[model samples]
Target: MPEKEITRISKFLSLVLRHQPEKINITLDENGWTDVATLIQQVNKSGSRLSFEILDFVVANNNKKRFAFNPDKTKIRAHQGHSVEIKLGYPPQTPPAVLYHGTSEKNLASILAEGIQKRNRHQVHLSPDKSTALTVGQRHGKPVILQVDAAAMHAAGLVFYLSENQVWLTGLVHAEFLHVLTT
Candidate 1:
């Protein structure tokens, strides 16, 4: 398929898999896994054409590695970023000394005072590197990157989970553990 088509399908998949599966009349299991056949059927039935071949291509070629298939290729799920209530079942992992979070410059003041909160999503999304954080921030507005003291947070009894896509996950980062890296 063409790149544009792939991108469109990928976004739609993210929407369904991460945020609104009901829109397509499919349901993700407790661990967020959904039957691949059901997903394709539901997607097509929803008036957005999807085939196994296209789904496979999208899963394989997604730039961020946002989705994954089961060992037998019969099931699929988003790696993370679920807005709906679903247990991702990621085990707590040791993160690096520091992680990064990207956001709009406009939010810096409030963030400096209030710390990073998960808001609507399951957890505060973090990046393993500044570049990735910058990209994430740019999506909102003028990018701002914040350095997180992950080691310190972990030492303080906070837990972290690294998603399959390599995005870090944590409950929240208090202002004490955050350092403004770029405005």
Candidate 2:
């Protein structure tokens, strides 16, 4: 398929798998997984053509590795960024000494005072590197990157999870553990 087509399908999959499966008449399980066949059928029935082969291609070629298939390939789910309530089932893991969060410059003041909150998403997403965080921040507006003291947070009893896509997940980063890296 063409790149544009793949992007379209990928975004649609992100929408359904991460946020609104009901829009396509499909439902994800408590762990955010859905039957692959059911997803293909429901998406096609909803007027967007989708097939196993196309789905496979999209899953394999997505740049961010946003989606993942179960071990048996019978189920699929987004790696993270779920707005709907669903347990991701990621085990608590030790993160690196530092992690990065990207956001728009406009939000810096509030973030400085309140720290990073998950808001609508399941967890506050963090990047292992500043470049990735900068790219993520650019999506919102003028990018701002924040350094997170992951080791300190972990030592303080906060837990972290690494999603399949390599995005770090945590409940929140208090202002004490956050430092503005770039504005």
The C-alpha lDDT values of all candidates are 0.93, 0.95
Error of 2 at 2 (Å): 2.9
Q: List, residue by residue over 1-183, the lDDT tens digit for candidate 1.
A: 788988899999999999999998999999889999999999888888888998999999998899999999999999888898899999999999999999999999999999999988899999999999999999999999999999999999999999999999999999999998845
Models 1 onward score TM values of 0.96, 0.96
Query: What TM-score, to 2 decimals, does candidate 1 have?
Result: 0.96
Candidate 1 residue 155 Cα shift, in angstroms, is 0.6
Q: What is the lDDT of candidate 2?
A: 0.95
What's the CA error at residue 21 for candidate 1, in Å?
Answer: 0.9
